[model samples]
Target: MPALDNDTVSKYLERYAEPESTFGARLRRHTDHILVIPAQDEAATLLEGIYPALNAVSVRGERTLCIVVVNATDEARTIVHTNNDHLLQTLTALGPTTPLHTQDETPCWYAEAKGFDLVLVDRNSLGCRLPRGQGVGLARKIGCDIALASLRSGSSRAQLIHMSDCDVQLPSDYFDITVPMSSAAVIYRFHHEPCGNHAIDEAHARYEAYLRYYVLGLRHAGSPYAFHTIGSCIATIPTAYAGVRGVPKRQAGEDFYLLNKLAKLGRIHTARSSPITIRARSSLRVPFGTGRATHDIARNIDAYRIYAPRIFDLLKAWVAALGALDDALPARAYGAVYERASETLDPLDLDRLSQALLTIDAPKALSEAAAHSSLARVRRKWAHDWFDGFRTLKLVHALRDTGLVDIPWQLAITESSFCRSSPTDTGTALIRDRDAFETCRRLARLEERP
Candidate 1:
């Protein structure tokens, strides 16, 4: 085996030194798997999520390392300090630590069984230096970086990094699922149940339906990226994780950006195993996500809307024209291809998109097709890379600005084949009738498949 890159390790430690002391030299050099969970004042959620994970690892009969980064943002509203203290007290009450616990004077905790081990890092501890309000993005990044460090230290034999959150319930077979060697990431299926509030439950359901609708539209448009981006519903190999430079360090939408980059690397497999169950609750934790969107719907039911299905039709035509662009250049019909595509579009600002394309020098991209030469192939890849997932979403928004309005969720479904029957005018009726959302669920699942 190659020698571990000590310099790289040092850089990470220096950058995140506050939590470094808690890590110490406790990482196992080789274990069956490494799982990372980020926590922020989730004392209750931590216990709820950890138990099933431990149970899953036991069934696999492989020694595993479960690392929980107990973190909190600097915001006074957060109960991170209180929560971490409670977590430490709970760990102390669990049992005595193994030899791995001997090196740290800090309140780091460790407990192990025949095939399972748990490690806790207190982000609010005196030694921890994570910034205030860095949010889930920073928390997840810290945990994943620690996982990668374990792999490099030869403490873990596992190549995959399992990422999850505190609000989820894992199944006994959670760790039993595996991905093909060619896969970059494995997206687990997830289900949400009503949290007893009629209004909140209805809003959550409507938001989920919108999520599925967007994915279905992407699939229909022939975009390579059509997968879900839930933070807790994912697992990825170290190579892919590092290749993308780990997850982004943003307050929100970190999962979306990370998975977007991973999709460009290789196929993102959708596991059909037992799905994780997440509890639905309104939150303003970061900015936007399931929680925030749920809150939005509760406040104004009509405020939450989806892109009209016709937008997908226009997107399909636009994406289809890209392939023709390459061939058209070879035939010296590049301008003809653009004019033809412009005529087919309904709401797209053909002039604006065309201007954007020209600014990127689309002709140079066409002449540099990979099938043509080595240099051409590199140029072609760069060109495609330029028009990434974020850009595509921007284009969609641009169309929205140019008169393509977002329709109400219920209306969008009723207008399409996805919902054979319409629900009551209010979202409550549609949410209560589980069957009404089946089409959206099925379509999302279809897009999930490899």
Candidate 2:
């Protein structure tokens, strides 16, 4: 059962949901699970690749509701609009569709597919297009909001709202995996599939390697919010989704922000089920992410770099010191925190850490947090909340700006203590040969460890 009351969920949907799309009588039918996929100019992949993958999912005695939000901004190019129109036409021709309701002159349709109930949301039509600057984030919110409404109304047995993209092939056990009710969200393990294009495949390898490296760095640094935030690999509990006020309506980075908030609410479970295989293809979608990284890396792989290992060393020291704060300390206890942090660093690195901390105003922030709460646990919670994932990334950038600059991916991997201890060799040969795909495989193995 959902943790939120019907009135509360209804209010959230009314305010943040896509208008009039979840009220159809046909949508009240029972479903065991719900999966939302946001699509733009992805008709061919969604129809040919994703649809078959969803059908192959092994969900015995369970009905899955798959909502695909076909969206485009008003400023989208002609090619995008044409593709969306074609996608809608093709889907409508699949089988008879029950016309749900129209929002902003766009129609929503429901069709029963082989393994799932398909809800095709049309946000690409003339007056129904998404607003300028709102891209995948808005499209995702529309689909998820409807899913949440169904769950709240007892139309679905699931308390988890699954999110994915048309570019990925979900595993056979994707819907069968079990998640604890206490969890705020679950992030499925994923790997990028090698496309026929060598350049694109190599670029994806490097990008995926960089992502795993960053997360491993965070884990070594003792950060609680150390999970992957890929939008396509996440499933949020209904309560946590509502608690965070739903997904942000940004053009990009929605996954990062959503998981960041969800982490504070409860544990984020990482699934060990068969991994989702994402297609390795370059795209100009939205602003930045796997697509942008792939495009940039294929152009100049040498220019792509990861954060310096020294940066994570500094982060590790800071996090350790923060965790050591005591309630017995004075109201302005940042001095002790800084002292503990400095003890972990060499003299030269201490100066760099000091400068980076000063740049982020860590002293003042820690002082304020201590002053606000005398209870040790409360003070620590306040500090952690203040230094959330966004601030952590900002601190990393601040360290880069202060002194410790980003190094080549190969050098960072070899120099990182976290990678050095891995079963695979962290050698200079990685730099000499520039085997990015091999490096990616090594990092993926490291990430798969218990």
Candidate 3:
């Protein structure tokens, strides 16, 4: 096993790091459409993806494109970006590449950058890069903020806007597909797929356990702070997004929240349109509740951790049931976590919220419970939703790199020692596989357009 030392990060950097490969070489890169990827740290994975994703976008046709990185941190910004000359030389080294503008900066700066038409942000930094305020919802809000700023700055118009997590990997044709899929406001239900996860160590197991325990254990479905937003991976029309005003920048569940507000602005359109090929997550770090979000929701009576959808009643359940499960828990007092959550969430807004979840096709059971149950009754059920979160994931990202798949020296990844559980084994593999994905992607392509 590779030691988890500097050597570990280094080894992956040197050997396992995904650079150019035959698979990547063949993939397309589009230059016409601007692909704004707002992320932080994500160096390793970004390095793996940037080139191919660029190539993929370039495939459709040649157009001026930019990969804007709304880098939150200073150090990472320096490493990921280069001055104009260095960037040009790097492009020259890559040989026969199209014009790609890449910029890394803080929120205020990127929002005002020129030609940043399409924006895609990553929420994986919730664990690392961003401070407390800048998470999934915050990221989305920032993107919207930028769009608003651009509009105010008289940048003509900002057309398409998308927010995706670093955990996701985009297909070679996402841009082409997104061109037509951009709607006023929508939540494209993704078929959550899984990636391999066999290398789970003891700590890893506990982490996964925590996710399962926290999400499935509690009952309260939507904490006002539920931040049920899907982090990244949400696409909304630029004007529509700006029209909604702004979304709270919570670290988790940003997608769910944005979708909620978006529904109110215009017709909440749910389409089976062009779907993005996102890869399943590897680490269990960003599960429904990141083991960090907490609050007391029910009039200081109950507490619950909430980060997924339909979490109103579940939050109540956690508050009511905290004591019942306290004796069973071996770790930190679970009830205290609930207490904290209850405190953090905004006051219960049952009538308004219950009506909304139903409109989104949130389970009839949740709606029934919300209407019949008090605020406290629902908050408790959210405690252990992580398990279901894992089990029920639908759409997944695409796999763009080809570094460790065929290395002669068993370079240790998909076929290794503790490769415990992955999105594939959890059952969404076939759905996200290249062949399956191609089939799915083809479904979006009309009978005529190639």
Which structure among the candidates has the greatest TM-score?
2
The best candidate in terms of lDDT: 2
How high is the CA lDDT of each candidate model?
0.67, 0.81, 0.35
Clash pairs (backbone) in predicted model 2 = none
Cα misplacement distance, residue 65 of candidate 2 (Å):
0.7
lDDT tens digits, residue span 80-104, model 1? 5776768766754554565333445
Candidate 2, residue 79: Cα displacement in angstroms equals 0.7
In terms of lDDT, the poorest run of 10 residues in model 3 is: 395-404
- Measured with C-alpha atoms, the lDDT of residue 421 in candidate 2 is 41
Off by over 4 Å in 2: 1-8, 20-26, 51-53, 56-59, 102-105, 328-331, 421-434
Instruction: Give the RMSD in angstroms, all C-alphas superposed, for model 3.
Output: 18.7
**Candidate 1, residue 111: CA error in Å?**
2.9
Candidate 3 Cα lDDT to native: 0.35
Candidate 2: C-alpha lDDT: 0.81
Clashes of each: 11, 0, 113
